[model samples]
Target: MTNILHITASIRGDESVSTGLGTALVEKLAAQSDAQVAKRDLDAETLPFVTAERFAANSAAAADRTPEQADLAAIADTLIAELQAAETLVISTPVYNFGPPASLKAWADLVARVGTTFKYTDTGPVGLLEGKKAYITAASGGTPVGSDMDFMSSWLRFFLGFLGIADVEVIAADGIMGADGEAKIKAAHQEVAKIAA
Candidate 1:
């Protein structure tokens, strides 16, 4: 069966627009593809921020790892396994000060282990996780997605691409703190419906 991984960063819980959009898309996609959905709420279950020791532990071979290293590497192991098992990924996030939240950043740091997620080549570093499709459901209060001020979407897209998830689609509700906020959100939901269709 196909697996769809939905990762949400917004702390807004029931009130998050990005999460709402992602939920709609995931429901539709799951029904259409008969896929099993795996939800990861970063806000509720925060990942560990990568430190030098944690990074070393993650890079070490499983067989060679000490008990302490094993404890440190466990989260990365689970996160990487989630990525490896999924055929589709959905990241729903709101712009926090023109960027992604600390929780999401921490998840990224943990999952991006060398020789696990990506590797170096004679040419350059190449992503190991291949042939996966990803979607971003982004909601920004004022920062416009795809604009210079919108570091969240661009950085997320680049980061995902670095993991060989190059096929990405962005669904955004930007400038939602503006006068046309409701209209923009409604429009984004409509877009989600059509995408699912």
Candidate 2:
């Protein structure tokens, strides 16, 4: 059976548009494939930020590592294991300040380890993780399509591609502000149906 990891990054819980859409997509994906889904609510169960010590530990040779370094390395190993175990990933992200939340970035920092998820090569950087597909539900306020506004999709695509997850599908919900909020949400749901189909 296929293993799918669903990560919800919004802190808004039931009221989150990104979460709602992501949940719906997960249901659709489940119906279409015989997949076992694992959910990680990052907002509720936040991941610890990487520290300088953790960085040092990550770069150390296995035999030359101290006890503390070993512990940190073990944590990183666990994170990598969780990612590697999945055949697919679904991320629910709310755009904050025209980008993803700091918490989401922290999760990325932990998982996007050099020599683990990716490596620097002579050609540039090559992804280590392979054979994974990702779906990103991105929501933003005050920034719809065709507007001279900043969006996080570009950065997200770059980072995910660097990690070797080349097949990413994005469902974006934008312009959730002021008088157009309700309309925009309805439109976003319509878009979701199309993408999910």
Question: How much is the lDDT of residue 79 in candidate 1?
Answer: 87
Q: For model 2, what is the alpha-carbon lDDT of residue 95?
A: 84
**lDDT of every predicted structure (CA atoms):** 0.93, 0.81
Model 2, runs deviating above 4 Å:
61-64, 145-148
Superposed model 1: Cα runs more than 4 Å off: none
Clashes of 1: 0
Instruction: Score candidate 1 by lDDT.
Output: 0.93
Per-prediction RMSD in angstroms? 0.8, 2.1
The residue-by-residue lDDT of candidate 1 on 1-197, one tens digit each, is: 79999999999998999999999999999999999999999999878888889989999999999999999999899989999999999999999999999999998998887788899999988998889999999999999898998888899898988888899999999999999999999999999999999
Q: What clash pairs does model 2 have?
A: none
Could you give me the TM-score of model 1 versus the true structure?
0.98
Q: Which window of ten consecutive residues has the lowest lDDT sum in model 1? A: 108-117
